[model samples]
Target chain A: MDSELPPLLVLGPPAVFNIFKSQYPHKYRFLNAFSSDLPLLQFLQTQNTHPSSVRAIFCNQRQLVTADIIRSLPSLGIIATSTVGYDHIDTTECRRRGIQIATLGSQFAADVADMAVALLIDVIFKISAGDRFVKKLVPFKPWSFPSDSKLGGKRIGIIGLGRIGAEVAKRLEAFDCIIMYHSRNKNPSVSYTFYSNVLDLASDSDVLVLCCPLTEQTKYIVNKEVMLALGKDGIIVNIGRGALVDENELVQCLMKGEIRGAGLDVFENEPYVPKELFSLDNVVLSPHAAALTLDCFMDSCRHVAKSLDAFFSS
Target chain B: MDSELPPLLVLGPPAVFNIFKSQYPHKYRFLNAFSSDLPLLQFLQTQNTHPSSVRAIFCNQRQLVTADIIRSLPSLGIIATSTVGYDHIDTTECRRRGIQIATLGSQFAADVADMAVALLIDVIFKISAGDRFVKKLVPFKPWSFPSDSKLGGKRIGIIGLGRIGAEVAKRLEAFDCIIMYHSRNKNPSVSYTFYSNVLDLASDSDVLVLCCPLTEQTKYIVNKEVMLALGKDGIIVNIGRGALVDENELVQCLMKGEIRGAGLDVFENEPYVPKELFSLDNVVLSPHAAALTLDCFMDSCRHVAKSLDAFFSS
Candidate 1:
């Protein structure tokens, strides 16, 4: 192994982790926004010429990697990213190139599920509005009381019965929320009733949770049509992805009381707010932070470090 | 019973179906409020003269009815409130007066449990804080991320092992939190450990929930000593009563990090935030509205109505 060159190429944000960089600065090189263009690619290509070691590729959940970038890493043996979804990575190309790709699992399941639960309570109890009164740094605290709904004996329909969805079910069990889920494939072990239609699940559930992956089939799955079927007081919580809900339709339904309220962790576009969401007091919105936390990031670092260690050892 | 008057005298804020003088319009002849303590005892003596009607009395969870008041209601066969806690009603006085008292029971267990779970998520995930920044009529959508703290593999302690505590435990079971509990009397049905000392329970649990009733012995149970024993980063949730936690010590401990944070519904002095807690952001405070949901309260009304029907029929 070359002693002078970096042992790995990490493709992600360069947080100021003093311990990590100081201890192994020479062994790790970061490929951030500054290192992804044509000239930088040429420089990285030259850097990858050292036969004694390979560069390790790292990306976050959001970034898109190109085929050219994957091809350039001739010495790349491992691809690691801090996410459960690796759709951004060209898995087919990586398979052909003899590369081992590793991504995060449900390390954020409880956290995301917790966020979903938090949103459910927020929408139900008006936590977002209460928070506003707290922030104006208000002169007086509002006389906000508990709302009109309870989770118990209410049907909770969950879409995309994956890791986080299952975790939500398990947690809601304590609250006595009836579990109703619809997924493309049935999970026999889960014991939740299967609904043939997503709208059918929506119609029955008091709270409809969006946990499905972003695909053409599931796009705008909770549109105006679905919300109407769900009824006027029904709640919608989306923790999986933004595109799964039709933002315009959701806002309209909320305004007209076709659907009661929504707790949204994601939106159709990144860092943009739909105008209609602001008009309704029934919705609670976060900046797509369902999987962001200090603990989960710390876990991710450990996972990435282990994967890198294994790759080097191999 | 007189057809003109509402049968029950609800002593506090009324729901849509639950009629109380405070929330009722002035036109509503059936409801009336006593301002500045217009001798409710003396008035009840006069009202009870009509023993054929007004079979029961209802009060809000916060209303203070002294022993003298309970002794005055000769025809008050049943005293009911939509809460699990009955300390406000002077239950001893009711027992002495031969007045049967009833409160909402196991039906609201999951609802209260869900609130506890919601508060936990609110405190840990910073849900309230995040929403305020992102959607709270704020100038900018400050970049926010979801908190990633998984609920698996943490020791959780319940101070009371009653219906709500058991419900909370069952809900957390799927999340894999090690459940520990301490109550004066232990029930054999639960699998959780029965810790005798509050300090031991505080030391062992990652989260300590005060679900026990308020009694002279249980008052200020989570004082400075218990808070200190909890250590930094340990969480506390109070769904039982504010008196169960010492406000002064809790403020000091929270500021000093003796305990991590608190998710509180009840307060020693409610709606009156200790200036110290307002200064500190480590606590998530609710307006003692844990079990005051519309559905739960309505259910309580139906329960009381049914009990009244049966009691009167006999």
Candidate 2:
């Protein structure tokens, strides 16, 4: 390690640490926590330098920067997370301590929007279901299977018309989808119809794409009533947080065909998705990987490095 | 049946016959072949009316209109098919006999284009594969799976820049993909780059989308050499006829990792896909349902009925 290099504590999924270390050459001396078998507190205590030397902590959603973790890092000036969502970090504590926060921000918008559209298209066209049917060697009769819905001219309701939602709208527009949205306030920049309430948006739309962050007011935003309003022909695509939808209601609706289908990238319980969803052909499930594309991940890695460099220099 | 009503022969999948009969009402007297237990010729002979009275045939890809079938209907004037591809009919024989042929034409282009983009996104983002992995209840880890490729900034070469190809290019452009083409002639209407030779196009593209019609000159157009040119990271999306690609070569290339993946909606033989494709996560297979969306199917049915009505009126 270069003596002149600034030291930063790196805590996240081992994969992120490895990628940053390998792909991003050393601008900072990364004190990788995974390199120590000891617990995080003990690892920090055992470091040759004082805890105050580490001015910034590089992390992601995999590791939470709880109040305890923040307290232990005596001189931590900023919590730089390589994810758009910072719900995992102790922002309240950071606010009290006057420690700033830096996030990947809109850097992940395009890749996540691509995933939202991809999932929506997959559901409407029955691509995943058709793939299973073909691979299972089911006897194919001409026009035997129920016909799929076309993407063109369908009204798509975007729950959050933020960066990702705007990108989703832009892509789906080429498919001729009617774009509608529900957000905190009416956006003056775009011409898409805005509904203040999500229920009204669901009733008038064919598909609902969740792209909002998980906040107190937005948690369980898509409940049973909202789903019913979307009707039996509706589809739900969640590229946002898992808790944005009530997973139980979603599973029940999918099971009973209350809603036509769903393409879920995030689940309430995460890796512990309802086993009932396993057999449903109308539903397409993905692990939480909306922003995991190589391009997005590398971009985020670069953003994190830049944020750290700026914070330490200031 | 009304004596003034024009008698017409309907031979195709039973679904088409049922839908047309139920939806089309009393426009004409349908001499449905499936209604009789006897062979088609015998069924016509057993009918009290003369075979020459049935002057038009309404069929689809499910039924072949061969020279023998045409010979039996001495007064046959037109063969109207409810599909974009007219290769199923004996066009050469129709030309010799001075009989007219009508197809759905560009009506199915939008639906087919939608499927092409859906398949492309599904393959590139690993949507189907991710769905399978999540459904299979595999242990999920952050950044565990290989990072997926992004759609933006990718060079996509369209094999046939006709109506369907043009529609596909329009949709993909919204995702920020660079569009190139290989067609019979340079299409001057659009500004997309055109390549007269497909090999050069393959070399320049990261993805190849097949949208051309299948004919003697175009059969086996994407062979081993083209696949090799596409390289290991390249993907092939076939929404056109299956015979356009050498299935054996494609299967081998996919198996050897010579090419990244494939999204096939058509095959050399109908309903008989290669068994090797069953276990591959890199491939998404649809049972020839590209133009089978409910909206598209109903539209084509209406078009077929109009074609038949026009022929009978003349």
Candidate 3:
């Protein structure tokens, strides 16, 4: 085990531990931490630390991650984030370091796309909020309530054209909804048109979903300016990172009814959600759980373990 | 206006009103009701003091409607239900009355399909429960509550294969669910295999949705007998009619968990719920609101208006 290769370092997603042990066996020694924002810089940069022992740095956006952690892993030959979005990692630094980077395979388009459906339905239907009420473990006046808004014939906008965007388009086939998207390029997957800017997507969309990743090219994409353009009678769902949206802008839009509602699974501070966001009835907040499922967890773990096997075997 | 003839009578769903009113115009006066039930019959018997003026009887399965309604209306020439289910009209009586029984061409299929999808998700995901929790207008522990079970790779069973049943098939195509169904005749719509009886469908299905309408042949179909067959890991969704399933059987299955959960939108006695069923988190209840969209309301109203047009025009 020791002669062939250095140890593998998995730095995010607690679900990855079981996956690594099962898939790779006695391959690279795995260094995994339970929480995000682990003190990787301090831990590895200590005077006596051996940087040559690490081979790869695997990451996920959530779990309180910091970009500096990846830069400090001197022996990280590969940097992979389980999610399609990689803004959590310093990609420029990885590129400069000649790190081979990987995200999930392109076919996982449906994972994010299907989740977009789940979140969209969650927003329009107010599903998560409704579920909590019923689970009160008591019986109440079931029929005495306000009527929910229906999703039929509503307008929706997609803001990206990557794998996830195409899959979201296909699944929405029977909804009878009018579709418009703001993709960097026109996609041949569906007849959905491309809007040049986020403004166009926001202006007309009854439901505006952020599918684009958060990056220098796309960070704070849904700012106060864009939220103002979106106006009221609109809903937003961000399955991507919270940094992609300006928290201050979102709070104002929601408070002022500039946007009717939002369905957010990711947050600006995650474990420390803004108290105002929690109190809103129109918003459905989940703590960074969109990309999770029993299957996704197990599969991602197995993939990382397999990568560890290659690093050790070669 | 006096020269134009009143439109013939038709029985069935009220969705077919637009076509007849828009196309036939002043040429027809219509007689229409939103439902095929005992009240409609009692109303007709009282109204039709003489038969010579009546032109047709359009009807579906509900009341004991037959030759008597047609005989009472001697001028009756056509009968129709805006539904595929024709159990109420008595086709044999229509044949003897020399009445042309016509039903609406496109039926409640798309709506029912969407409802089934909603129910399947609701039953498993506890959507109604979620709706209640959200409506509470309370602060919730967002991070702690999970999305519940997922639909990927679960086995789903559908019963009945008429119009609505077929649409359920088309919409579930994107989900990675294994599909099976039970219909009297083999459906050529998709590759889903046929189950000869309810027991077979119950035995294999993780979720069992009632798509067949209520009838003497199908009444009390999902009794304690089928509940026993479903074992413990089953979920049931009923959109067909409340009478089709024995409510007691449902309560028992839920209490003992012979079935894992259920989502009920319609009931044997609706707008008046069974008090016993209210306390279970294993169930989701709505006031038969699946078809209660603005589109449905407008469509039903227009159907009544058009039928009046046809009746008055003639």
Candidate 4:
């Protein structure tokens, strides 16, 4: 801990903290909350040795930076997160306080988009299901084999036309899919047809991809009516937060074949995926790791470092 | 069985035969060889009731149309296959006999390319592996979770830059991959870097995708040397024919950790995947059904009918 260096509070686990230290050494003297025995608020109070010295906080997905934490750190002027979504942070309060917030925007977009497409194709084509079928050496009969739908010309409804949603749209265009979208506001640059609400989008779409952020308005956005409107042959892909779709409704839809399938990378309560999904061949589950690829993580670290450097230089 | 329709010889199992018949009823009276207990040659003889009446042969992947079959069908003027690859058909013999061949050309390209990208991302990101890991409730720890490479910024070497290969390149380009290719002859239309030989391409690429046709020149093209050149962290995706890669050498390389992983839609033998691959988490296998999506199949049937209609009208 060098007193001459700027104090930066880190509120993540060891893996990311260690990477940050190794990649950007001596730039900031990091006080890791995970390594500290005291509560995060008390830890912040201890770091306030020199008044207004601790001007930066670094966090990842594992920690929440609430209004209380913000009030406790009076010197904190900037919060840089290494994750794409900033729902874990109190963005409204931060905005009111004039505290600058930096996120790994568009860095995880490509990888997350890739995962979304991967899961969609996997579900529609039964790629993972087919792999399991073959690996189990179930009798090899072509006629008896499960059939899968083609991706071309399918109606794809994207929930958000932001960076990740746009990337997904671009990739699916090569497959000749008909792209439609629903967003907070219509993007003028894209030619994709926009729907004002999720219900109409689901009614017209064969597949609904959720790439929007999770907020109070967005939580449980894909309710029973939306799923029912999507129809029996429809599919859903969520690379965004799990809470965007009602988990219980989604489970019922899958079980009753109300929807054809789902490709999920996020869950309502992560690391504790519903056991029901395990037996369903139509659903593909990932452990909330859509953006955990090596390149994305490394790029995120670089982005965090650059944001910190820019903030201090300013 | 209608004598008024043009006689067409059908050779394959029932699955594709049923689809073709349902899609194009009364276009051509199909002579079902599989329905008959007699040999395929004998079946062809039975169909040759009127000389030059049986002008076309329709076949799928399950059976072969050898030079002998071409000689046996003296009145055969064309062969329209419901598959993308013509390796099962004696193309040279047909060419020498002045018999025109119509294939499901570029019809399956998009679907196959979709499968190729699906498998590549699956291998690179360990999507299937991660699903299995979570499904099995393997103890949850961030560090213990499998780490996967990213698709963006990877050097992707394509074996053939034809219809399917070019489609693959186009899709991978969206991921920010640097595309290089090896083909029988360089395609001047595209600007992707071309290598005269695969060895050089393998050395420079982090991933090698095979989309070339299978021929004597291409059989076992990916041998031990090529795998070694690709190094231990390399990935190979084959949406082409199985014999394009030396299966034995590939299994050894994977077992010994000479290469990173593989995404195989085809195998050296149909419906008989390498048993060793069953235990490996690094490889993703399909039952030679990359282009067998329902849309591709329906489109292929239409193509075959169109070709037959044109041939008769001419």
TM-score, chain A only, candidate 2, equals: 0.91
Candidate 1 regions exceeding 4 Å error are A1-3, A7-26, A31-54, A71-78, A90-99, A127-148, A275-280, B1-10, B13-31, B35-37, B41-56, B72-76, B136-148, B310-314
> Among the candidates, what TM-score does chain A have in each?
0.82, 0.91, 0.84, 0.92
lDDT of each: 0.72, 0.85, 0.63, 0.84
Clash numbers, per candidate:
3, 0, 48, 0
User: Which prediction has more favorable lDDT, 1 or 4?
Assistant: 4
Residue range A1-314, candidate 4, lDDT tens digits: 57788888888662356667888888888887778889876776776644356798898766779998888778788999877888889998899899988988887788889889999988887777777777873444443233557788899999999999999999888778899999999999999999999999999999999999999999988999999999999999999988999999999999999999999998987657888998777888887778776566677788888898899999
Per-prediction DockQ, in order?
0.44, 0.63, 0.14, 0.48
Task: Find the number of clashing residue pairs for candidate 4.
Answer: 0
TM-score of chain B of each: 0.85, 0.92, 0.74, 0.92
TM-score leader:
2
Task: Mark the regions of model 4 whose C-alpha exceeds 4 Å error after superposition.
Answer: A1-15, A21-58, A67-79, A92-100, A137-148, A306-314, B1-10, B22-57, B68-79, B95-100, B137-148, B306-314
Question: Which prediction has the highest DockQ against the true structure?
Answer: 2
Better of 1 and 3 by TM-score: 1
For candidate 1, lDDT tens digit of each residue in B1-314? 34454456556543323433334334223423333255664454555534335557666665776676565556678876666777777878777778877777677777777777777767777776666556645445455443335567778889988888888888777667899999988778877888989899998888888888888899999888888888887889988888899988888888887887888777786556676665444567766666666666567767766665566567
Evaluate chain B of model 2: give its TM-score.
0.92
Better of 3 and 4 by DockQ: 4
**Model 4 clashing residue pairs (backbone):** none
Model 4 Cα lDDT, one tens digit per residue, B32-131: 8767888766665777655356788888776888888788778898888888888988988988989888888886787889889999988887777777
Best to worst by lDDT, what's the order? Answer: 2, 4, 1, 3
